[model samples]
Target: MRVLFTTWSSPSHLYPLVPMAWACRAAGHEVRFAGMPSAVPGIVGAGLTATAVGSDEELTGMSASGKLAAWHKQEQWPADWPEHPDRLSPAQVELLAALGRKQCVIAERMVDDLVAVVERWRPDLIVSDVSTFAGAVAGAVAGIPVVAQLWGSPGVLRYENRALGEEPLPEYAALFARFGLDAPVDPAALLDPCPPSMNLGSALPRLPMRFVPYNSAGEVPSWADDPAVRPRVCVTWGVTAAKVLGAAGLEPLRRIVTAVAGLGAEPVVAVTAAQRELLPALPDGTRVVESMPLQLLLPHCDAIVHQGGAGTALTAAAYGVPQLVVPQRPAPMLLADRLAATGAGRTLPHHVVAGDEHADKLVADALDALLTDPAHRDAAVRLAEENAAQPSPAELVPALAALAAR
Candidate 1:
């Protein structure tokens, strides 16, 4: 069988779909990844076939100028977002509607090009990132079965449902009509990577796919290879957070480093060169490297302190490393709540973050609690056991092939 995978232009969006594509290829099936022009290089670099489509000059330009992150940070709800999503304030409803509208704009950019590719390729199965509705539009036009890969946050989908009745999606009804489909969009299945304890209790059809960490590739260093003499903790932030918080975002990450360093455990701060520029000083015994493959680093760590990006959080869970989630954005708070539920971690509210007058002390206190407590470590092990039971992406391929055949 031939499979075509499509995703949004962002690295956060594209990286989630990579392991699954590799799984399909290893199964002796032909696979191709299609994305907007800016995303194709990443797809090709990952050793997958790249089919570039559409243009991301506008989104790319916004990111380069830091306008996109600033926009996202303003609408971000911190703590109350996990409240009953069905009954939200008009302002909250408006925020959800605005998010959907923006996605539709991005979707519009790719759908036409995606449809053109689908027509020419005519693959047996179509797999797409849940947020990338362009792939759904194209697969519908091509009359093939489509599966939505949930990078698996129930909070995200739960948040998405708020905008459902308010809009018909993409605000481009003509395209559905152009493709001869009656509904705006639909998928045959949703492959979710989140554990049940963490997922939103929605009615959408869901299939299980274990969370796998695929942090962008980096060269391994000699220091990383050496076994640590004491408990090692990782302090880091995702790219989205840096962009959203701008220079101030580094404050939260830096605070995490100082807090963890004082706890007598080793703190490894993984940052890119661009990110390192914002740092003022490093705490004693705290090592700050430009960056490293997180999957390689987490296995040796006792704990992780982060801004609660799903990729990093899920990766930490997979390795059974206890974590302190100092969430800076709306979505990370939800992920932090779910991680806290597992007893593997604790989520800090926005009040304890960068804007707080005593942010550093509060973070240090949290880090101390995570290290001194044994329960967090025990719970992390249990969560890891639970994930180990889920079928990996490779295990799910035959089922996908069966679905395609049906």
Candidate 2:
């Protein structure tokens, strides 16, 4: 079988699809990852064939002008929003619609190029990031089946479906019309990597797959081999959070490092080369490591402090490492909340991080609890067990092939 995986240009969006793509290849299925030029390096870095489709200029401009970050900025959800997605207020509906529109704009930019790729490749199936509507459209146009892969717990899709109905958004409708298609085609299946314990409900038929942490290949730092004398806490802001949140984004990460240091734990601050340039000097004895994959570094650590990203959170959970999540955006906030509910971690909201003068102390306190609390450790271990019990990506390949064959 020929499986083509597609996602937007962002690392967070692309990384989640890596393990499954690899699974297909390991199962003797040929695979290729298609994306905008910005995503090409990441695709290649993951040891997959890369098919660059659309230009990166528009997204680059959006990032430079802060529009991309603005689009990600989400205020706290209403008290009832999470539990009752279908009964959202008008403003909540608009919020989902606005985000859908933004995503559609990105999809619109790539659909034509993606369709061209589909026509040329004639793939047996399409696997896409749940939010990458372009892949869905391209699959529909080419009469191919698509499997939507969720990054974490299902959130955006549920809200979008409730708020906007099954019809395509105006932008999506325009894209469909361009190819003479009448309506958007739904994915044949949804692949959810989130552990069932953390899963928020979804109406779509879901196939649960274990979350395999893949943060691209990198050289393992020599220090990682040494035994930790004290609790080692990893602090990371992911690859795109700083770009999305701008300069202000580093503040929470900085505070997390400080708090971890103050707790007498060794703070292992993982950063990209670009992020390293923008970060200020850390406290004495802080171990700043660059380009190290979290899967390699996380197993050595006792706790993790990060901006709540699905990959980061799930990676930490898979290792049974207690987490202190400082969520900066809406999606992260939701994941953080879920993590807390499961007793595996705690959340320090963006507002508290920005508004509280005692934010550092609060962070320090949270780190202290994560390191000292046995209940947290026990819960985290249970979560890891739950994740381990799920069907591995390799196990899912035959099911996906079966879907495509049908």
Instruction: After the best TM-score superposition of candidate 2, give how far the Cα of residue 269 lies from its true spot, in angstroms.
Output: 0.8
Could you estimate the TM-score for every candidate? 0.91, 0.94
Q: Please, what are the lDDT tens digits per residue for candidate 1 over residues 272-380?
A: 7778887658788878877576887888788998877888888898899999887755567778888898899987765457677888778777777777788988999
Q: Give the backbone clash total of model 1.
A: 0
lDDT of 2 by residue, 298-351 (tens): 999999988888999999999999998887665687788888889999988766
Output the TM-score of candidate 1: 0.91
Model 1 scores a C-alpha lDDT of 0.76
Off by over 4 Å in 2: 60-73, 79-83, 86-89, 155-165
Segments of candidate 1 deviating more than 4 angstroms: 60-83, 155-167, 170-175, 178-180
User: Which consecutive 10 residues in model 2 have the weakest lDDT in total?
Assistant: 63-72
Cα lDDT, all candidates: 0.76, 0.83
Looking at model 2, the pairs that clash are none
Q: Which candidate ranks first by TM-score, i.e. highest? A: 2
